[model samples]
Target: MHVTDACGRGGATPPSRWDPAEPDPVAGLLATARRRLGMDLCWFSRLIGGAQVIEACDGDAAAFGVHPGSTVHHPGPHRSHALAERPLPVVGRIRPEAVTSGTATEATGTAATGVEATGGPLAGRPEVGSYIGVPVTLADGRPYGMLCCLSRDADVAMPARKTRSLALLAEVLSASISDRRSGGEYREAAWWRIWRLIDSGGPTMVFQPVFDLPSLDCVGAEALARFPPGSGGAERWFADAAAVGLGPALELSAIRSALRAFTCLPPEFGLGVNASPATILSGRLADAIADIPADRLVVEVTEGDRVEDYPSVRCALGVLRREGVRIAVDDVGAGYASLHHLVQLQPDFIKMDQCLTRRIDADPARRALAAALVHFAQETGSLVLAEGVETARELGVLIGTGVHQAQGHYLAPPGPLPLPASANRTRPPDTA
Candidate 1:
């Protein structure tokens, strides 16, 4: 059966109505919830024709016939159906007799419903011993579906805090669904394309040289994520991923892909990877670069999301620093926060943003600001790197300002491979 859109307009399509073979973001959320919550199974179902139809599921739910595209009839008073009718979360233990005998009669007494129950699919399942669920609702307060988990252990219990956590997960699912519908066909199509790109490992890794300005020698190469030839620019692709709540996942994937090129890079050059503060705090970054020599890796924190807990972030970075991993703050001089981050983190390197680097030769104010940053970095013992040197004049001004390192189209563009060692010292003309 086709799922109706939240708008109740016949033309709007629901997530459930999409092709079953397509990847459902809700499925990923359900799987994550199940693993995080240590539940036997988790599934998302929508109410259709007085029954619950499983649209996405994870774990062992499929063993009991709770698979995607499967329909389970839950008459008027079944606990699962009753939970879906409300807008709040519900959690309760299933009686042992319900699973032992595959009967609803004994379990009905413990159910959170005020109405009597007729036998339903959930009642016949001899595996589910407890249930916790949150109603998925639309922006207009209408119920869209339910995100629920079931466990086979009768003694299983969920804390009050866990209920709230489940509610938040449900809200994320609701928002993702709403985005798909509200974004119209173009956005929905774009989401699918990006989803495929990520799933197929569509991004290719390229390295651009970062040069030490005074010595005119390449000291490092920043790993940049490049999509397929016709897949559009990197910025647009990343923006779309962020819009769909897949930003961190994609960034992590890119980092992992970039690391594969470590062996190909020259031993003297540090491998730089761009990551947001959120990704840095996740601790997964540590694992991604763990095998490589820590001193050869530079974690350049990109200015994407704001850091909420500076102390926690500092502690995480400290652990990596102890292992010889260095940190670099990207896009400095672009905003006040970047300067604040410089002081708080005391990174090993500070990268000047392109906004300040572009046309630095013509702008005295920018030159002064760059010089000041250079002096600050000098005093703090942090090396300053000027980014986006597109012209000879910009490079000359950056060099005059005592910027230790610089990189841009003027030096080299990202390529499938790093420039050979012989070409590292001489400044290459703008290739683009």
Candidate 2:
């Protein structure tokens, strides 16, 4: 293969392998692998139009011709071709003499007479002293791409266990690609549906009351997105939008739709909106709610989105906080990272995960955890909100544990558009 540097000298523009608008979803995975494995460089390559193109990469390997948009022609001898044909993991030290002399190594299986004998593109790169790669294959056994790591030291050696771990990561990337590629027609139709929804002024918003535990009176309402008839659940629609690289646009549209309810809500009721950390950091949320009073808006950071940089997130949150926008760490107890978020961000609200509050009245263990979080919120001077309180017993338990606020069907189901004037006056069901 004719491996050429994308960032070549003389100011020549390199061809791009990915859609410029869409965020590289697997970029974080490659970065994590490089960091954990202590490799000089890490990258992912996909065979496109008969050539292997670098799609994503991280670390100093960029200096060694590893970069997005770089291409390696699938001709003659090359390690990438071998991996594509056999779909096996490759790891070994690169002999400088062998590479410069145009000799193919046993590990790469490149032809000795073709590109190797003529000093092909990959040859004469002294920086690449050692290399390791795992085939990223599709679910049906087709070679989709390759995950590779390289080092500058000739004697570098990776343990078999590490190589296996690398393979597992490749499997994950493969699965993600498979999911994006599968259901082609369905996804295309869904994409159009979502695009039309956003272009036509976005989805409708339903307000669900959040009640103060002691007073049993509405203190706020979380804006829930509801699509037009037959558009599917809000979650699925958003996921589909993200897979198609329209996540930020769709989310911004939804936020704008949700914010319109601020005028309809009572002055005493705060408005909570769900958003991913990426959306928050994008500064779009700040601009969307610029006209609205920040105290009235609670930006609940959604859980499970991998956060690579905590400092950047914290900085973003700080900017919003200064503008009176309150932050809420959503889905607490759903994952270990949630706890870390609570500690790091020190948000104004802590919304316990539904799984932990599902049956807290009957589960002592759940109650204890909820109680502890409530106490933590108290110490942090933040309000504790228990989500998905479906039973009077659960509501009673939440109140007893000093949870400041809550929202679920048991308190008040999400109300339709043009919410009734009494929506903010919703009271808890009579437990007596």
Highest TM-score against the true fold, candidate: 2
**Residue ranges of candidate 2 with Cα displaced over 4 Å:** 1-190, 417-432
Stretches of candidate 1 exceeding 4 Å from the true structure: 1-180, 184-192, 422-432
- lDDT of every predicted structure (CA atoms): 0.73, 0.73
Q: Judge candidate 2 against the unseen true structure and give its global Cα lDDT, from 0 to 1.
A: 0.73
lDDT of candidate 2 over 1-432, digit per residue (tens): 222122121211222234355555698899888877777888888866555677788887535544677664433434445545655566766666766654424333222112232314455565456667777888888787778777776644456766877888898888878775665556566666766677677788888888877787777788888887765798888888776546766777788888988877778778888888777777667778889988888989887467889999999888889898899999999997788889888999999989998988889999999989988988989989999988788888898988988888876789864443332335655464
User: Local error of candidate 2 at 383, Å?
Assistant: 0.7
- Cα TM-score per model: 0.58, 0.59
Which lDDT tens digits does candidate 1 get at residues 295-315? 888988877767778998899
Q: After superposition, how far is residue 42 of candidate 2 from its true place, in Å?
A: 26
Residue 331 deviation, candidate 2, in Å?
Answer: 1.2
Candidate 2 has its poorest 10 consecutive residues by lDDT at: 3-12
In candidate 2, clashing pairs total: 0
Give the least accurate 10-residue stretch of model 1, judged by summed lDDT. Answer: 5-14
Which pairs of residues clash in candidate 1, taking residues 3 or more apart in a chain or in different chains?
none
